[model samples]
Target: MPELGGPTSAPALLRPHDPAPPLLDAARLGVAAHRGLDVEALLTWTTDTADLLPLPGTGSTAALWSALASVAAADVGAARVLEPHLDALAVLAQAPTPVDLGAVGAGGSSTWGVFAAEGPGVRLEAHEVDGGWRLTGTKPWCSLAGTLSHALVTAWVSDDERRLFAVGLRADDVLPAAGPWVSRGLAQVVSAPVTFDDAPAVPVGPPGWYLRRPGFAWGGIGVAACWWGGAVGLARALWDALGAREADQLALAHLGAVDVALTAARACLVEAADQVDAGIDGKPSAVLARRVRTVVAGAVEEVQRRCAHALGPGPLTADEAFARRVADLGVYVRQHHAERDEAALGRDLLAAGVAPW
Candidate 1:
């Protein structure tokens, strides 16, 4: 396992005498203001060394563990480093039968994101064109838009139909919005709105295929794995803070609470991974994904709250690593969509009116 603040040159647990891992590469990431992460290195390590992408199911539980470990490491390592790759993995998951996973695995050289943030804000539209397809309009919340070479994007194909398109971000007429992102938390991630002018694209799947796929649900739950790992990182910090040193009963109690929360979250994540690997046909996968995401999100919040209460402002303010973990987790978990997702899941379950066990 890679040590928190970037991997140690040598294994620290086995050889305590070994030098500590190098501190995160600040220069590669960026300076103080709006830090840009050195995502390439992180992606490279995950691809070549960890070999975590294209998540070949059944025989590949290693990918799940590796994904969780990397996310936790990212929380300690770069804070905003894992999102793009996660997006890419989700893309690879739903890719068409003819699509090549070989090129995509090594295409860590070419960073990717799932640019599907559509709303009153910025909605991309796809049109059938002379050769392949063309996408127009704008995509918001495009993480690493300026840097991502490829993206699995969603665009409106018709009033009632939306399709997924595999696009080259560097293609002509696509523009990354500037000056909109203004947050220190997950600031290493460069998310911005983008404008497109009929950029050429290749359709990944047919209309409505993106949201209809089991991978869509799996991707939703996979996010919870990262959140679970992040909470574990915070819980470990609490453990380290207590150590053998004397602490008040309240602090110890809070640590206990954090421990329980993280343990439960991990179990849910593992079970969800198994279901995802085994493939539950139809809405059962979606149901499990929603249930697990909801459970893990709540656990993450509990861990965050308990850690803050027990540890106080010192770690959140003074300790750079702990602060980043807390901050990034806060922002990243917003992918949960709070009540909106809950309402949708609840309404769907109500409509179905029976548990699919």
Candidate 2:
């Protein structure tokens, strides 16, 4: 990892057993058989790895976000590792508590165990119960379900309203549906639907919390890092192809342009993180989040196109790692904020005389 200058100049910690590999490689395998047992281990491993260090007196916002991106690229299988660590992250970002710098870093496996990837393929509804909340419904596309300790799921509070709640999953909270995930890419991701027949859950925050605050924007930005990492993987693959003389001049030019796009996208991401750390409120964060997503999405698309063109039909063969990356990139890029919504935000920023710093 590159040394980033700040008040907190300590080296980022990684686990002793942490093998520094690409994000996809780390996330390749699905969750361990005993997710509960392994979640803490992964977290410990991440902290030991020294990747997630606190930024001195302020928040670990930038470090955590960067760690998420690194983990996403390292292992799409384990990409959701940070979900369980959200509570700790929120605490670290919001409070002035002295962060255990020796604790889990972003790429450590502990953070990945929070999300479970099974569901009933329907949106769930949450009801305020006597003690807490009862979640009854179905949720599709719960990635990493089999191994996650809990899932930070978004569910409607009740019918006919837009209220959303972030619920944590437990053993009895969710059950997997039949059939496996048949997606073209990220097949090992364990993304499936889950059913909650009056499952009990604890709400992370108040109603409408998912949509409000910097968490939502930050979540989007965090996911965007995964896409950006995928782009990096694709670009590297393209570079390898060029080295092998498999790419033509046009393909090479396109790859160069992709490099430019990735650089620009990364700059925007860091800038957004800085702004977020500085406590620049409201629309600025939203706009920066949108920009990071848009730039990354575009970069991934360009790399996919260039890689496909350069590598020819052989690269698409299922056995090839590059082919798998393309599929993963496609799935990851779809998580970006909508283009129209981002554009409208940009327009609002411009109308408000927001100047780039």
Candidate 3:
């Protein structure tokens, strides 16, 4: 991960001994960012390096999150595309009967997205068809569905159950909705609803296993790591501006505050990664994930506000790259669910009475 200041720079997110640190190239990502949302180039890059990202809970989870943060620091939009593809690979790898990437996509360059978000009145159902399964109806929140080769989708398998299935996005019947996505941030990512008209599918795990798996919680933490990285990018902008000229007292104060927030967020992530590798104290993974995400999200919010205030209107108005980074981070950090997630964590903590001091 990138640092903010001299000597007292933020702690390295990846350990010095981690072998996977060299696989991520900031220069390559910076070049890719100049392409402006070319899905093919980005997806191809993701495919080539998909296996290099460390799987969560595999004892090298810090390296995984660190790599994610590195990608976001280079370009949040690129991270937007890369994280899910890496996540989809991890999900398949953790499946009870793991699916083979080669079997799913030709030439080993398949890009995948996870389509698990559900919306009101939107129903995607899986049914037994000719000794196999098929999906029907619409699956909302299918990001990059139009461009990806495959996706791990969650759909209703019965009246009361939903299971995850790996489906080819290029299947004839799969329809990725167009338009209605007008967000300035993440303009490169097209997160529209995808309708499956009897699309063929293969189940990744048994009913409810997707959520029950430990990796599910770890995946959520990985996303928080990316949020932390995005915040780091904003902090770097402020740091660079301050170094360019004689800075005022107020701007210096903002930089100090940003450092404090990022320090706490990084510590939370490091501790959570350690716990995940140690089997999470035999507790539900959600507890650990929620705690880390809440802390990181709060830190990200603070960094955004402080960077904006310190930099004033200059970066947002004149610097295109800085403007996009701010916008992309703004949209990406919302994955944390704000107060709703906080409420859920509080209820769980109260119910468990763990006395986490």
Candidate 4:
């Protein structure tokens, strides 16, 4: 709603017939990445949307719906950019010390990693200092790299005493190292290496709390929502192209397949949102988040296939926006972690076993 550079920079409550809130800001973030504006503007854009978070607090379906809309307008890059900020907000909402949610609600991003076991692995170490705590270590896959003013970092205390810490990145000691992400899709959302050189920090939760928290699964499902949005965005190409040109029987078949898969995907999201909200009564939430992600990812992949099959390489190569959208969504939905997540789902599935009709 502030003067972001792409999509609908003009603010409004909602699009004419759309159920989504004002989500056009994602377009601005997407174009900001494409335009090579750096992460500073991205930070600024994310910080401006204070009202976007659920008012009563975090964990609301409203937040998920809003994120879905945001992702739909731009792509998953925009969703990925804002997701961690929401993750931190959710963390703070349930934190021991009440952070000024209004103040910290502004822009920033951080990512927990796919790091290796011991060795020179990316780990943050915490020390009990006079003032508070200080962190020193390398954190890999630090998205938004040097641009964000703050980040919720994961660090180790002693042994496997891993904890999440809120650290100020604007401080002099912390160093965000430039590293190559080397992916065509999310190249704009940089995931460089960062080092905290005795930077002052505060513990977000007790040891191992980051993983134990319900917000972890909640945030994961939110990413699924982005993938769901991306599926919608990518499928739009099919909708428009198919409508404009006369479709043969095969083309109609492809369109029909896309519709069915997307219907299932959308239903998954709506059902998942209800599940997430229902789980707020201290129950474990959304065993189906990974399942939902897999469903949406499959739907997105199917849509990509059907769109390409129906329309061929002409529109893909010819329409820059369409091509870019397809590529971007392809890379972004991979946050699903493929079968690794599927394995987790399998374990849960086995634990729950089969249901009898």
Pick by TM-score: which candidate is best?
3
Q: Give the TM-score of candidate 1.
A: 0.82
TM-score of each: 0.82, 0.70, 0.94, 0.81
Q: Candidate 1, clashing residue pairs?
A: none
- 99-169 in candidate 1: lDDT tens per residue? 54333233546556787777676678999876568889998888777866778888998887888877777
Give the per-residue Cα lDDT of candidate 1 at 185: 69
lDDT of 2 by residue, 1-357 (tens): 222222122212222333333221233222211131244555444444334344311444555555555544444433444433553345334323342322112222333322322344467787877866677878776665665544456677656443333344444656866447777765655566777877766555455544565555666676776676556656666666677676667876877777677777777766666666677556766776777778778877876787677667887875355666667667766755467867776796787795765
Q: Candidate 4, 211: how far from true, in Å?
A: 1.5
Q: What is the clash count for each candidate, in the order shown? A: 0, 42, 0, 1
What TM-score does candidate 3 get on C-alpha atoms? Answer: 0.94
Best-to-worst order by lDDT is: 3, 1, 4, 2
Give, for candidate 4, the lowest lDDT window spanning 10 residues.
1-10
Local accuracy of candidate 3 as per-residue lDDT tens digits, 1-357: 347642123335766666555546655555445644777788877776666767777888888888778777767887788889888878887888855444435235677889889899999999988878889999888888999988999999989889998888887799999757998999879899999999888888999988888788888888998889888878888888999989989988998899899999899998898888987632467888999999999999999999989988998999998999999999999998999999999998898877788
lDDT of 4: 0.63
**What stretches of model 2 exceed 4 Å from their correct place?**
1-60, 80-123, 158-170, 246-248, 337-357
Q: What tens-digit string does per-residue lDDT give for candidate 4 at 302-327?
A: 98888888888897778876777777
Model 2 TM-score, 2 decimals: 0.70
